[model samples]
Target: MSDRMRMMVVMCAVALLAGCAGGLGGGTYERAEARRAMTVDYGTVESVRQVQLEGTKTPVGTIAGAAVGGVAGSTIGGGSGRTIATVLGAVAGGVAGSAVEESATRKRGVEVTVKLDNGQLLAVVQEDEGEGFSPGERVRVVRDGRTTRVSR
Candidate 1:
């Protein structure tokens, strides 16, 4: 494979990943932050449980890996050996890439158990990109539809 083709494969991989990625952690998606987003839950944070934010590895990662692997494998040999290498590379790359993408995108998240003012306790887990919330800190749980965020 030529350098140009390899570049294309990489670019395509990046573009594909960009679309499926749900963002590193927190951000308003498709909806304005204040649009119908009311303070659904106001509480004192009882605990901030640290957890891993697993990332989704769909077809994008697999396809991207296969493309790059195929390209790389094509350079291995001529005739049948090349063909076998390409196939093996694609399979290995797909698996490895999926894992790599997932690992790369994995982030720090927290299961925030809040003590609502009404004496009821509920836990909301969301990605924590440094949205500081300490135990006993007052925070707001804003909700719009199925989406929710914990913020100071």
Candidate 2:
């Protein structure tokens, strides 16, 4: 056998051995399978009440401010000016009334806290009873697209 041929055989054996040992350092040999897990955060439902608001309600602060301003504005004028001032006052009162009703309506709702299985917490205000969720229970969290929904 020629010296050059023997060297070539030795190099090929070494290369094969190196290839076999490539994945020995905690490296995975195959692609890992991905999985989906559910996480539920728990919170109590205080009350399941219906909150209704007329479409015409205005905010309270605006109404209160307008009332005070109108009263003050009325004081600045008398007689026909008073009539003008009263008209302005009536407009202001209507605005104020609507605002007050809106604020009151806005205050009616339920607050719930949901805890995810991943230890993340969320606070939610839901108008309807969040279906299948209870005050002290574990819920399965499922991811739908980009949003998370909880199920009992």
Q: Give the best candidate by TM-score.
A: 1
**C-alpha lDDT of residue 6 in model 1:** 87
Worst 10 residues of 1 by lDDT: 23-32
User: On residues 9-80, what C-alpha lDDT tens digit does candidate 1 reach at each position?
Assistant: 988877776666565344545545544645577899999888888988687788888888887888898899
**For each predicted model, how many residue pairs clash, with residues at least 3 apart or on different chains?**
0, 12
Please report, in order, the local distance difference test score of every candidate based on alpha carbons. Answer: 0.78, 0.45
* Candidate 2 displacement at residue 27 in angstroms: 48
How high is each candidate's TM-score? 0.84, 0.34
Residue-by-residue lDDT tens digits, candidate 2, 99-129: 5544444423334466655566755443333
lDDT for model 2 comes to: 0.45
